[model samples]
Target: MRALQSDGAAVVHRDERAEGFVLLSPQFKQRWRFVTAHMGNLHAVLDLAKVADTLLFVLDPLDGWDSTGDYYLSCLFAQGLPSYALAVLGVPDLPQKKQADAKKKLGKAIEKRFPDAKLFPLNTEQESLLLLRHLAAQKQRHLAFRDRRAYLLAHNAEFVPSRDSDLVGNLKVSGYVRGWTLNVNSLVHIVGHGDFQMSQVDAPPDPFTLNPRVAKGQQKKGQDMEIQVSICPHSQQSASVLMQPRKQQPLQSEVIPDPMEGEQTWPTEEELKDAEGSLKKRRKVLKVPKGTSNYQAAWIVDDGEDGSEEEEEDDNMEDEDLMEEASQVVESSEEEELAEEECETMTIAESARDDLYDEKVDEDEEQMLEKYRQERLDQMFPDEVDTPRNLPARVRFQKYRGLKSFRTSPWDPKENLPRDYARIFQFQDFSRTRKHVFRQLEKEETEGAMVGWYVTLHICSVPISVMESFRQGMPMVLFSLLPHEQKMSVLNFVVRRHLGNSDTVKAKEELIFHCGFRRFRASPLYSQHSSADKHKLEHFLRPDAALVATVYAPIAFPPASVLLFKQRSNGMHDLIATGSLLSVDPDRIIIKRLVLSGHPFKIFSKTAVVRYMFFNREDVLWFKPVELRTKWGRRGHITEPLGTHGHMKCHFDGQLKSQDTVLLNLYKRVFPKWTYDPHVPEPVPWARNEQQLFMQELEME
Candidate 1:
């Protein structure tokens, strides 16, 4: 029903009574009549022979007929219905497990019967609609064919002509030549096109193996496809009786030819010999002895009778032919010989190439050996020797000296020392021009606080304790003068602020060199303190403020000491400094006083072999210091007038028998400023003990 509706077929009632019978009957109806009163009980049992090309069977599940579906189908096949003719329709109450089995059985039964039926399994209403749709299609094709608008082509013995279709119009058929045979209901079947599946099927004849009559008929039919108009030849002569059309039906069985008729007769050896003897006799008859009467057979040489002029021309060219054949043979032989010679030459060349390759390899190995030998010689006796083990390189580190007073000093015009201190303190002037917001403080007080700020010296990290101490004096306060709503505070280290203030006094008075600082907007103790010390001060400082300071940031320092150098030629020791001069003026640096003092005590007695000197004002602090030494030079010298003025170079060439003794003596005498104070308690006694214990365990282990 769905398919019919999709194809646009109309539904109409022609036999109302018969339709009711079909709906009520338990058996499937075989046929339908136009008269409504001529209805009969639809017997579900099928008669294969009576079934038409279009068989419509409608079954109903609600009527309670079940389990015998396969049996019912068997009856349809038994009566000779074509497989494709039958249509089974129903809402059969078939169990899921049994459905497959039932379908298989029904399919087998149908296939056994007609083998080409188009079986449709559908419900009652569906079967009725499908049949109607098929009938309507037939009517349409019939009208089209009647109008000569469509051509019908039939295939096989079941010859139903193709109802006209615009899609496949006027097609020429070629394969196998024979036209289709169709039944009245338009069902088609091929007569000889009944080829079975290769497996489990009888082998089909090869293309050449033909049923002779059928083959001839097919050929004739193919030729008939090409229509020819006959033209009469002008023939007044009467035609012969031998040329009549064939009317005899060809016999379809095998026929034996006459060639094998004497196969049953056996020949004796003598008879076989006689047959051979007859051939010998014929040869002997052809041979004529030279002197015999039959000897000069005229047939042997009748040139004029047997030979044409073309034969004489061929005979004249025979010498040239012999010459050409001889040349061709010679060329072929020469080619073969040349190929053999090439092969022998290639073998000899390859052998020579191998020899040259071996020689090159041997030369390379010799070169490598020579290089290895030279390297070994170089290792045994180096070009230059290093200094004796007892002597240490001459190098020195010393303190700097500076002006005695905190006030600005005059610069020497001759030496280029500034007459006005501004030149020396250019950065300080620049520092004053910078802007800073002093929150909630008088202008005079803010100005006074901006005097001389101090910075902590550190190699790397800032000391936390020092920073914390500085933070205690700096408290948070609202900056009313500022436009930004953020809160800020300023530490009043008066000297760093202006000239001097009470807060500055409260801060440590001494310029604590090497005191590191980490800047923080909030207190370092606040939750906002970052773990890193080198972060931009802007993180902690306001944009308006030029500088911020934190004194307790961690500091890293290398172990450095002021050491004297002894000139290799001299045996004098010099004292580099007097006090623990954290910083010094350049003039006060005792460069001459610096000397190398080793184990045997280079200073025989005290003529003051080493003495410190306090020079005229010239010094450097953290910002101004000398550059350190280079690895290759005898010693480094500072040309700058910064703290570098104190640099000294001394070398020790005197043999130091014991290095440890020399180091101890040098350390004690040269850097007298370095000492361990027993009065000051050790900060980490446990750490010291643990280190000792670790060393002991390492030794034992």
Candidate 2:
């Protein structure tokens, strides 16, 4: 095996016998685009998966089936590719029984994951040729299917309106039309924009090259050609923002102020007496000895000579005790009298007899009762109290309720959906959308002029602002459109309120908002606002604000031949997202969706002897203790450093054999940062510059 120094090591084997046969036999000649993908490199797998027509998964008996291999298998299956096959590599001189056992074990493992896939032993040249023939047959079938589908689309072509030019008269709208036979006079219909006559056709240069295998004499003229057309709509297509349902805020209970304050209602006489009796039963008094007075305690001698001062102090103390007794008696008597008076007043107030002299008291009582009733009414109808006579009796406010999982839920094509539900976007004429190519375009391009291999459109109609977000580098996507028969009624509502100074102030008091895939900006529809409005706007700037805007985003319809949608890109597009089929109906289909791309992570082996590519020692250290997962659902963690080279010791729940793979999952938050030059050669190497060397050394340290 000859090792190639590239992004990763690639092994090339040349058999002398095969070389001579190749020189002699014309049919034996072959060309291959060999790529060596490092384990755990999802990006490399994704890139290679796009170009590879068939997958050949090689399992080594000595190394065994590891998590790394399993991950690649899962990725391949997920792609829903055309063909799959497996090859078991082992020593040619190994015992026949041992080889048979190894093959059997590997076959069982592959069967568990991919039951339909064919397995073969890679022992001799004949076996290798058999695998090659199998792949070639699968490729032929795939190409035949694609050619037939392309022919059908070309024969019955349809163009859906994707974008319109800004010019007014004879508006030259540009969109992609599948179905090949479009001529100068082809008539087309634009859904709501009305029927129009094609004025000119602008065929884009074919992006695909001619097949090298086709003999010069047998080569067909104008193969794989696409034409861009310019046409004028009878009337300009109306532009409207597709709105999603706004989330509803939780209802807040009203706060009512206390109306009766300061005044106290005295308890009835009987109730007061009962209260006093309970207090007496609960109170305890301690007795004091009669001879233990302050005067007696101070007198140490009992002599009668000059004892007159002591006698005076004793008399004073006796007088103070009498006064305290008198005060207590007076307080008890006063409380009894107050209680009696309160009872008398209540009796008088409850008396039905009308007396002229008691009119003043009755009037005061009536006034108090009226005030209490008015306060209750105000609490019940706070809004009514402030509403003007001209205001309507029923006031409706716009409401929004957040969805737990918006992708799988049924949403109306006409109603506004929450921004978070804007996971999938469907472009009507996806082929015409500007694709960003690394190489410069031959002609002058607009801001969103580069046609990407994939076109993304929101499943629901997006706002003009969101549609314009392409300028801000939002990813372009093509969503699987919903079928017409599956369409449902969507509730769309718009509430306009004239917040006169009072409403604005109240709204600004404590404002809260929601932000997700959608953005919110103040509309110009409302009249001038006070300082409170500005404050409310500032409050929305917070990251956790729950504020959302309501705009009508129309639901997009899926293009024809939904199953064949994958073939639309013709190997040029990348599968950046995946969705699970929720339910299918005669008219509609529901899907649970997620954006496919994420940050890239590395996985290291847990074995004592590590044999894989690593840039430096620091790479190993940084990955230490990081959790690694196997494809079969087992997990392990890196424990310690293995050596000076980039290797580490890892521990798993169960002892891992040489065949077990340890992988670390990483994600990509933004795709543009990870973009590569399409025209650049594969396995791009690090430049041998001072800066590169320094960076490499820094990683090592």
Candidate 3:
């Protein structure tokens, strides 16, 4: 039963309900709803924040907020924070002597993260009521990532199965539409779940409509949202299905490459006769096979006949000879992180009475220790690999070629790209494309369901298990995909290493990401974040320095924040890094460097003889064009080889000491691994680390 108005004011029913309710205030004359959620629940807090107009954080009076709270706060700030307010409960319950001190300490703590935010003491019901008044009147701050897209916070979701299949069904999700108008023909991506097409949209009655409350009063009220047409008529569905030619967007993520559809067309008799009559003298540009087409011949010309292949074969033969004595062992470190742990995840028991001493031993402890030592060694000697004493240096380091200068040296981004690069997309000008997309979105007035409209989307092909998960209280968020946003592209993110994570993170390692409303796993290539066109690749993610993380992902425009996470053995995902989207440029050059160190055989004024750099005379001559350097701050070059056994005379700007090591810096372009997965495993939900108090009766006998 609803509460009757008393003295010209609408009041809530005395009975408590699980569902959220909107407040109808007589003092402020406004309607509002309160969405309360447990801060410790990871998915709950984040998914709710996405569609929320305002957030009110409740802090403890004694202690502001713990480290765990701070961790989630950083995530919210990075993902995009809407207008928020802070409040402290139980402030008046504190002792008179400690109340002032607690308030002062709380001010200093919150000042760091929220300097301008006013701290409200909300112990009394009256104060809490006043807080809502201020919150409703305050202006809201918009998140750039969410402002231009249509999204829904799933308040009520139900799966209606088709008669043919129980597994597949149309998921009817209802909620208020936020952001820009949502087009019915567009695809919607359910967070965590994959993208699905909408069958149709239905306008439903708003559950939180407060118009009935004013009907009980004596005064006439203004008309708010009225539920006119319940289900959309059949006429509108035809218009949505058969949209204008230009209005329809294609769902193809990749362009199909066809070999049979080339320029191998047969010439007609009329064309052949005309060519035979007119062409007395014709130039044969390229010599191709009998059935070769123009496209295949172009590739053949670009890749010269035998000269380059024979040269590469000779180099490979020489390289193989050097490493004939020994083979390097390669394995992925942290096997637990690489492979999924099948063991049961352990959880903290609730009560002290059920105390069970938890003791777990790591089987690979020694391997982890050795890996840490190797990481330390790499840090001390950055990229320095010792010369193989048993084998020739040319074979061990054949894959690398020396660079004159990492910054100034020219390396084409298109050269030596892997096969996966062909399947990816590239943008001519990302900034201009972004502007045009946003400009088109602003013209959404002619189509789509407008904001604040209570509409249900018929998400086709959603599994029944998704609805079961929704019933279990998992946060459900759905976002409309923009044009071409679902296509694959090389995405670059400007991120800083998360300070909380001390474990070593390296390039080309698989990591889970939360970018805007999408979560996925991808292997990213790391490079120095710089203004120059060419960027030096980093083997390890460094602290206190920003790095550009390049990964193959679906195209998302800039202004989206990125949160990087790595899975732990216990099934929890740890936040390792955070930043924002940089760009979608596939042409950015990232060069990986390998250092070859050699000892100075003999030192002289402006000249020195170096050994162990190359095993054969042919190897020295091939790399003579490349530059060299010494450990003691000297620049040099290989003038000529003194002997066949890898001894080369070098000229330097300054005299080199005998103890100084001769170094050759070789570089090659690096690319991310082809391991882009959209369905990232859901991590163990966040739980509060509650302390249990144990009491024992006096041990007396």
Candidate 4:
């Protein structure tokens, strides 16, 4: 009902004795941030829940628990906090028998949701002290699960031009390290940027503290810290280099000869004249008479009888035979030369033909061909458009239906029923069960409230670089099959791949598939609903359905080398989903891909005012540490205390002006730390992890 403003600090509310009586124990002092129910802002509640060590759910005996109260309770449960306490008010004045019965009924309701919560009476001072004691004891255990200790390795770095003439010799850098343990002495390796000797690490003091005190020891490990490092830029490259694909080189045999070789050759004038004379002389063609017969006559040789004559004739014959052998060898050499020339000509022809076939069609020719095809179709069906055959005869042309607004209709209890109405349980009270299950949501809503909500799921076994991005607060969304419509189809595809070509039937009906933080278990049992239940579930399968089943599967950190990170110039890491294995089981298939789509904008500095693109004052709180990058690749961070009208002050390595364009990157990197691994084999239903230990204990009771 009251609000107070504090200068240079967050507003704090203090209750006076007249307004509300307070009881303080000497042993411990408690600080509370009161959040009212009528505010209707769930984000504020969630933010407060993150900082609260323990949660208290207050219930009035007379009012009992209504839809609004259930909604708040569900928000608290969604946080998955370690400690919870329930306080039932207005029970002290009731009769002993009635009080006992009320306590038993309330206990049953609370146990169903928070099995491990401690119960107490609101009017009892002793019980309040006990709740505080329990919360203090569990604080350390919860902190261990929430805190992640990791270091940030620099992904990109650049030198900032010095503004002051005195600091000309020194080089300044406005880059960030994505991990913790960064100090003045920390030697950071920047890819594509040399490892400079850091002279000073200038970091802004914590802004939350009203009167900040200088820390004597090393700085604490937390979210990404923007620090300006003054260093002497190294002239030589660093040992660490960004990974890149290797360039392919041509092989020796595949290399082509130089074109200049053929051009450099020249024939002498004497050789050219001889070649011309041979062409002029041409072939010695033997001319035949007009009346000569076409067929050639065969000649036969006769044998000689005289012995002396025979010896002389044999010598002449040997000389003639040797001359004939020499002529044959010359002719074979000429034929080989001709064959080589023919092969060269054929190769040239083939290359020319290939070039002609591969040529692209002219734009004019393409248009002409399309026109011809359309004309031919038009001639075949002259009135096709007027006499459409696909549409129903009753369908009205140019008339629009309100199908787009169908989901906005008011809730009708009778019209909307559960999926399995035909197979209703004999003893089950459907209305009571619905109220109990959907206590956190509005009464009119029938589907799950948290179905489409996006949360960053930690992945284990990711590459060291990707892990650095995670540590820096990059949100990696866990896309589960429960939120998707085509989950059954994808499951079938995976099963078929796993079975290969074998026609053997799978013995088991149920199969579990895990990707990132999502764990999906599908079986025939899930589909075993009554006819009415099937109808209800089928409604959810529609494209416009608002409700979905609540998925409570365990999630864990992704493994190394499983995800890829690409650091953009605006200081946002774009997740490369390609080559990412979505599921290790079912033959390690890669199905869906995701990218971190951060909001981007341009800003500039004017006379004592910072100008930004399309952001209101309310949006400033959501996007902290708004990253700024200049056109020249210089980086900077916007300091707290944003100005009015989408304007905010920024800190950069160098000087800037109104005309200079600065890009802004805004994204949520901090995510809830999950404590359980969903991929562990043969996990007991109740004995999953320490978080579930209390639930298991309660289930046994």
Evaluate model 4: give its TM-score.
0.24
Off by over 4 Å in 4: 1-26, 29-39, 62-64, 71-79, 93-97, 139-145, 149-701
Q: Estimate, for each residue in 296-321, the C-alpha lDDT of model 1 and write its tens digit.
A: 23212222333335423433333344
lDDT tens per residue, model 3, 424-455: 77778988998998888777464868887767
Q: Alpha carbon lDDT of residue 654, candidate 4?
A: 57
TM, every model: 0.14, 0.26, 0.76, 0.24
- Model 1 residue runs over 4 Å out of place are 1-7, 20-53, 59-84, 91-95, 123-701
* Candidate 2, lDDT over the whole model: 0.31
Tens digit per residue, CA lDDT, model 2, 61-125: 74456655554454444434445577766645568778777767766886798787777766765
For model 2, the stretches where C-alpha displacement exceeds 4 angstroms are: 1-25, 28-30, 62-64, 93-97, 139-701
Q: Count the backbone clashes (under 3 Å) in each candidate.
A: 69, 54, 0, 26
Task: Report the lDDT of model 4 for residue 141.
Answer: 24
Better candidate number, 1 or 4, judged by TM-score: 4
- Residues forming the 10-long window of minimal summed lDDT in candidate 4: 587-596
Clashing pairs in 3: none
Off by over 4 Å in 3: 1-19, 25-30, 93-98, 123-125, 214-248, 255-366, 389-396, 685-701
Supply the TM-score for candidate 3: 0.76
**Which is the leading candidate under TM-score?**
3
Per-residue lDDT of model 4, residues 1-701, tens digit only: 11111111122223331122112222343322333322143323433344334556677664457654554454344333445567776787887778877878787777777687667664654555565555445552242212221122111222333445322233322222211223332222221111222344333221122222333443346421122212323314332221211321111111233445335458899989999999778633344434322221000011221233432332333333433443475478669978975664212245444644654544565575565556555556331232122443124221211111122423233332222221111213423443453353233332211221111111212224333332433221111111111111111111111111111112122333332222334321111122221111111111222211111122122120111122222332222111112111111111111111112222223112233332334333323223456555555544332333333444455555545555543211111111222221222111113323432343234
